[model samples]
Target: MEQFEAFLAAHLPSAASFHPHYETSLHQMLLGGGKRFRPALLLGVVQAYNTLLVPSAYHAALAIELLHTYSLIHDDLPAMDNADLRRGMPTLHKMYNEVSAILAGDALNTYAFEVLSNAPFSDKVIVKLVRSLAHNGGVEGMVLGQAIDCHFENQRLELEQVKMLHIHKTGKLIAASLQMGAYIVGRDDLAQQLYDFGIDLGLLFQIQDDILDVTQDETQAGKTTNNDEAKNSFVTLLGYERAMDEANALAEKVTRQMMSFDENLQRELSPTLTQYINRHKD
Candidate 1:
């Protein structure tokens, strides 16, 4: 994780030369502490296959993190969720201004693709990385899910509808993270399996998040709690107990699926998934 942070610091656009406030806002948000789950997933897949880190893998990981950061920024915008806090701090727009926040998000989004395209890999690999990211993070994936979420605001959404929305919004990039790692290591055989696992993992993560929003305090969570009651969340639809049960079930399923891999790989990957699940159980 430290290595990945160093890589980002070295490659990410410097805030030193740009509009001081704008660049500083971007730097603070991008470098802010959080679970680097997406990049970990990508790197875990590569380690499972090759047991070694690759330069292109680092680039891909950075790109995914940058993209994820951009999503968080935009999600908190006044036009979106209107969130005033993120990672326990004032959101970018709240800290600076709306226009600066928007431009920072835009810069991160474009820079992600730029990093991926210039990764030290074959053209075929680079193309695959770009396409996978675009497909999962673009119109058909996260964006579509966000659109649906905003469209259905204040309206009751059915179970399946909520699943579809989250699968696209939160799950696709996660699944793509695993797939991207598989591509980096040329593990085509494991791509589909990793993606399948990612779907369950992503849902589990989100469900736990929903549960925590109601169960934990703002200080403990490092973000606002009880904010999803008005949204189409599992806790809102299924109630807290049922949602927790669902999360536990998904965690069991993910563990079982991980066991399908080689013993060594399973051992290597299980801890990260386990920690992710256990972190929100309170």
Candidate 2:
């Protein structure tokens, strides 16, 4: 993890353009630091299979983080969640301006693909990695989910429908993260299984976020809280207690799924995945 952080710092995207604060605004959110959950999942999978590939895996991990940070930037915009804080700091739109936030997000979004294209991996693997990230993060996946969530604002969706919303919006990218790691390590056989597990894990993550959005304050959440009143969140539909029940059920299922992985992969994912799977309990 420490090595990955150092790699991230060393490889921090430099706008390098004449626009002065553009670069600063771009770097601040990425550097502000969230959980780095997706990157660790990808790198952890790679490490379980090939330690030597770990360094090369950093590119993919950074790519995921970049894309995710871009999403957060856009999500916090006035046109979206209208959030003021993220990563325990002022949101990009709040810290700078909406235009800066939008442009910065766009830059990071494209740069993520560029980073993946230049990754120090085989051409075939890089292609697979790029496709995974793009498909999951593109208009059809996370973007679609975001669209659904936004379009359905103030409208309550059925339980299964809400699950589908999150699966596309939040689950696909996470599943892709694990799938990308499998590609990097030549564990194609495990790709589908990992992706399936990641989907459930991602759903758990989103539910937890919804619960935290209500239960915690802005300070405790390190971001805007109680901000989903108009959104079709699980906590809103299921109630806090029911949401906790759902999380507990998913946590148990995810833990059982983790046991089914090969011992080394299980060991690799245990630290990060287990920590997150059970985070709602905290």
**Clash totals for all models, in order?**
0, 0
Native-referenced Cα lDDT, model 1: 0.84
Assess the local accuracy of residue 159 in candidate 1 as a C-alpha lDDT between 0 and 100: 96
Per-residue CA lDDT of model 1 for 1-282, tens digit only, reads 677878888886665764668678768777778788999889887777775655558999989988999999999898878887788788899898999899999989998999998898899989989998989999999999999988888899999999998998899999999999988888888788888888878888888888888888878877667777568999999998898888888878877787788875676577677688665565
Alpha-carbon local distance difference test for all models = 0.84, 0.93
Candidate 2 lDDT over residue span 1-282, tens digit each = 889889888887786868869888878988887899999999989999999999999999999999999999999999999999999999988887899999999999999999899999999999999999999999788999999999999999999999999999899999999999999999999999999999999999999999888879988999999999999999999999999999999999999999988999989999998678878888
Off by over 4 Å in 1: 15-18
Q: Candidate 2, 236: how far from true, in Å?
A: 0.6
Candidate 2's C-alpha runs over 4 A off are none
Highest TM-score scorer: 2
- Once all C-alphas are superposed, what RMSD does model 2 give against the true structure? 0.8
**Alpha carbon deviation, residue 200, candidate 2 (Å):** 0.2
Q: What is the C-alpha RMSD of each candidate to the true structure, in Å?
A: 1.5, 0.8
